[model samples]
Target: MLRFNLLLCFLFLLPGKHLFAQNQTGKRYKIDRYNSIYLPLGEISFADKLVQFKVGNPPPIKKYRDSTQCLHEPNYRNYQTPNFISLGCGGTLTVAFTDNGFMNLPGDDLYIFEVGPSREAAKIEISQNGKEWVYAGKIAGGKSSIELSDAGIDNETVFYFLRITDLKELCRSISAGADIDAIGAINSVIKLTINADVLFDVAKYNLKETAKESLDSLAKIIKKVDKATILIEGHTDSDGDEISNLTLSKNRSISVKERLLKIFNNYEGYDFEVKAFGESTPRFPNDSDENKQLNRRVEITVLPPKDYYENLINK
Candidate 1:
């Protein structure tokens, strides 16, 4: 059975709370925050979903098998408090970034917060889709960060899944293998999701009158960035005809792009791209009304500034 955090999983599914935007400071040379784009370390920035967890040959006791401990931010004390999960002798764990994904940054792209003094090692792999993975190097207990810069992946690609398999370097004590506190995508983009119901009327592509205020406020935040690429993607529920749904999704994305562009008409610091996935990319199954509502959304993804990234790469 796949172990997961019930509360954390439920909270992330709520509308407007799905994707978060990070607050970038300085020259974008260094981000002070972790996985979340909207909030800092104390907030909900880390991984939210625990896809798979298999205890190693000599697994830890039942108390340490609680996978929920690895859900949010890192909170492991130096052998004082037991706030992390143990991956047994040679167990494996896989996590999903439901809110944000990490991309190919110039520096380290991922950080694994581990506990214990033995410094157990785990082989790390990342994937855009959970089925196909790319070797992303390894992280020993203390040496917890890894870079995907040399992973032979396109810089524009973003990865959402991470699979960690213990190397079985150490198998002593109740908390065997690698003890994990949290996983962070250091080089990630800001994601903001808006519900389609709030943006438009049923079966219509025009912007709702009430949505202008929210969009305007959202634009104010986007305006603060020095330089970036903004992506607008539209999605729908599987309730309608596939072709019609695709067209609706496309039109809705264009509508949002037009409004945002008008807001940024005089500014040249941002570039925009639009995509429509229709019912192909649903956050939840469309069996219920609530799930359908969640599926119908317009996602706005903001990548880090190009100039800062290039400078960091050359450094």
Candidate 2:
């Protein structure tokens, strides 16, 4: 009886083979064209079965995998220090030392330093005579700096110095050596000396050809410094009506600016400010020819803003 039941089961499985063969019939399939093989019906079969595995089913994967197949990483850590300066980089530095051997200036002469490799900590020091040194402070990375204003050194013919002290355990090694990359000293402020009489034509808003020489000199002074600004002021004698004088003075100031623009060829980054006082701010009583000449002229003064100058020094 058991053998008869087994035969019945085998017969039941035969129909499944016929069904799989029917599903694959008339289906043009190619596994590999280069090596073709025609598979006959009943040669392939399908089975539905339960799959079981031992321990170690994974907890849900927390991170997605990157499949780009690129194995290299960027080398961003090799970058080192960049160059910078505090005081003497963009412009010149002037130290005003009195005859008595002290810095008489009311403000600080601050400077910026670009710290470099060797990881050695550094400090700045100042010297009045270049013999004795006073410790300023520690300098870290780029833009670290010190100021001489709070040093309270005397205003005599003083010499300033910067000493870089290495504080790293291995001794800091920079691309540059231990010496300062630059050194500079400040000089006394030089006031512009202008003669108004030579600056313009008499009773006219135009600058005289003779005044070109003076204007050229003024331009030279301006070109010597960075971020310098100019103020062109116009004044007139009391000989004319007050209203006419005011208008003339204003025109004169404008004319000066125009001439400067022409002379400088309208430098893109530079600027000038123009103003007219007319007969308001007189240099003299305007009674004598000399006094009238002084009043009739236009004055051009070059001034740098305190903050801007300080920034230049500290940069």
Candidate 3:
């Protein structure tokens, strides 16, 4: 009888043990403000509950410690119903948010973090209804933590998230007041800014053999963000007559557009707007050879909506 009771006890506990292990499989971890990753030792949920440390204080750990020793912050930065996207690269991570999702905020803040081997860079963009994206500018860098505040977000569902493509290993934790949706506004612009002199034969509109390298880079950026309205703007130095310079710039810009279209032949439902400014927009003064070299350039700016630009600038 004693042996039988022991056997019964073993059977009863077996299922419970298995279930407990399974429950911990999908547990979320935190990457705290101090740039540490921590697992929760206590029960934690996002539903009206705050994450508190077992010892009642923020846990301190050595900088750049192993993942297991790191602790994450419990509270997430609050937003005014905006949408965002984040991307991580080698020792850096970037997060961007737009004001077109929840509350039509004008400016969106991009959060950048440098953790380990990755370096972070962020570009904040805006759109009227999340269907377009316009460049704002590069946000300030060199922070372990940042909050993208002061963007003019109105009461519309703003779309935002992160794009984490460059890093070998990536992980994240987000505490949001509102539910996150995967659906985002389709981007409609492809902008490319390349140093023209570096890409062409000297004093000629024709592309040098080495120019393909730059074009190849442009091709890659375009491939990642497919389906965009392409605007190709060509610029030239202030050396020759304005009319001749404009003509050369226009030809060069057209050449780039044609090559891109051929390379991305399979991408359908996209339009192209090719224009030549011809020495109109000089990136640098034409006083020296270096500056003149800089002046001869191409700019691919995606024209989203007016509100998109407004939001980006305001943010």
Candidate 4:
């Protein structure tokens, strides 16, 4: 996970809107304040116009997605096996997804998942027309990412074909060459919010049974991307003592992180952090139980790989 430099703003009074906290170490944190946009939180696995895919022929014909254990389609929502287009030396796999052309974003535009720990390297290419190809770059098979911006594609330009040519040898069985679990996209998404009620039980830091299932799905989707930074923050209604409220919020966030860790513990390169906002920031007025419930929750924000934000500096 890449770190970004946030501007240091003081603990100014925004009244009921936001609050910043200072730790014993003198670092100011903003887990308590948030922008009230109507966006769903937790995980993001966006689906675009995916048309078709082809595996280079020694002919098992179909590859991973065809035999998917994914409970959901398009997004591949579940922690299934590395459903890849396993290729051997000189083998290739190609897919087509439409948005016209991938645009520039704070992060990658495409994500390709493969067997990890030991990875396979592949040559990547894109095409506006099936016959014409443009080399985007090379990707090593685990959770390899692609930003069309890095390939000189203009924003909003719709180029269709995504071709991955294998360049590595099979490490395990010969049939287990480059195992690709899934493919996804990245855009200008900087934050994702999940409703706390969906993740926790009332007055509990432990996840509900269903919440664990939901998080498992999210973990599968997110685990496909490389270099992810998971930030979990908890919030509460303004009913308890501020000190205790802070503790509750912190615990709740940690709860969510713990669930994710259950599924993601294998990815040692990813970063995870938990923070607390307590009752400082509320999404709705605490005028009723419904509003208070909305305020009392946890938030998870994933900062895309550092290369995502590097677009600004490169610009």
All candidates in order of TM-score, best leading: 1, 3, 4, 2
CA lDDT, candidate 3, residue 141: 31
**Model 3: how far is 84 from its true place, Å?**
12
lDDT (10s digit) by residue, model 2, range 92-111: 11222221121234343433
Model 1's number of clashes is 5
lDDT of 1 at 298: 96
Top model number, TM-score: 1
Which 10 residues in a row give candidate 4 its minimum summed lDDT?
Answer: 23-32
- Report the C-alpha displacement of residue 173, candidate 4, in angstroms: 57
Clashing pairs in 1: 21-37, 21-38, 22-37, 22-38, 36-45
lDDT of 2: 0.43
Q: What is the C-alpha lDDT profile of model 4 across 1-315, one tens digit per residue?
A: 122222233333222122213211111111112311111111233223333444433433243434232111223222243343455444566665432123354445665554433577777787766578888776763436677778786663345566667664543443344555444444423344567778776667777788887787666555444455676778988886898988888888888887777665444535687889998988899999899888987765554445335544697
Model 2 TM-score on a 0 to 1 scale: 0.39
Task: Tell me the lDDT of model 1 at 226.
Answer: 40
Report the error of model 1 at residue 235, Å: 14
Q: Candidate 4's error at 191, in angstroms?
A: 4.2
lDDT of 1 by residue, 207-305 (tens): 999988878877876654545678899999998899999999999999999898776653455678899998999999899999999999999877655
Maximum-lDDT candidate: 1
Which wins on TM-score, candidate 1 or candidate 4? 1
Write down the worst ten-residue block by lDDT for model 1: 28-37
